[model samples]
Target: MYGIYIYNSKNRNITIGTKEEKKFSLDIYQIYTHDPLEELLNEFREGQFSTTLTSKQKHMLLKMVRKNRPAFAIDEEPLGKIRGHDIELYLDVEIPYPPMLRRPPYPESLESRKESEKHINELLEMDVIRKIRHKEIV
Candidate 1:
């Protein structure tokens, strides 16, 4: 494959490509010098967010993020916990009894089902979701 190179210097902005498809050039050599994934991860960890907002707008956004920091997940972590967050909902519609709704099981291959079960078990272990036995439900 042709190797593409971009040069952005003080006086010039040029893109150069190697002629030979199979020949490995400096452009191709530089490609493997750094991992793009790792660079992106590092940027995320460093909080290097790029935005077109003005300085004042950016400050306001930063303040909001800092204030609601617990609500956002970092590094695949679960959402932030809000202390004393007991919620109650009052519906206008009245029902004689609790409604029971059930859906058919999703169609999945054996391998896919096993994978899903493994992931769900991991989430349960991590306390991301509660496991309720049939008897526990009213």
Candidate 2:
């Protein structure tokens, strides 16, 4: 006889007639939801998810799996849990952008400009810089 059984706790020993079977098992955790994709999409559409995420996160979910970042918990509340009647979902939500990566400071010092000019000159000498010039009509 073949059978599949789910136990609330870990079970190690099973006795059948004169034979005793011992098996080591680990806990199986899963996220359950009636409509996981739809729910995740709804949450994203409503702007209920975080935006912070690394390139890895984007590559994993968005590029690899073709799923939106907000749809998964990786870009928002990662440890958040959503409970349903039949299923429980675990999320690792993350914010989309890091504060530091946004709104970079503008260069305000002449020294900075000089350093940039030096670099540009070096690139130009190496023929690695292409200058686009517009002619003025007199």
Clashes of 1: 0
> Candidate 1 at residue 21, lDDT?
38
For candidate 2, the per-residue lDDT at 111 reads 89
Could you give candidate 1's per-residue lDDT for residues 1-138 as a string of tens digits? 445554554433333456433333232323456754455445446676566766566556666766777666665656554546646666665555345323556699999999999989877765556788879942
Q: What total of clashing residue pairs does each candidate reach? A: 0, 16
**Per-residue lDDT value at 88 in model 2:** 40
Candidate of highest lDDT? 1
Off-target runs (Cα >4 Å) in candidate 1 are 1-53, 78-83, 86-108
* lDDT tens per residue, model 2, 11-98: 4433333343433355446667586455545544644434786545533443433333433454334423333423445544455656
TM-score of each: 0.40, 0.21
Error of 1 at 52 (Å): 8.3
Which 10 consecutive positions of candidate 2 have the poorest summed lDDT? 79-88
Task: State residue 33's C-alpha deviation in candidate 1, in Å.
Answer: 29
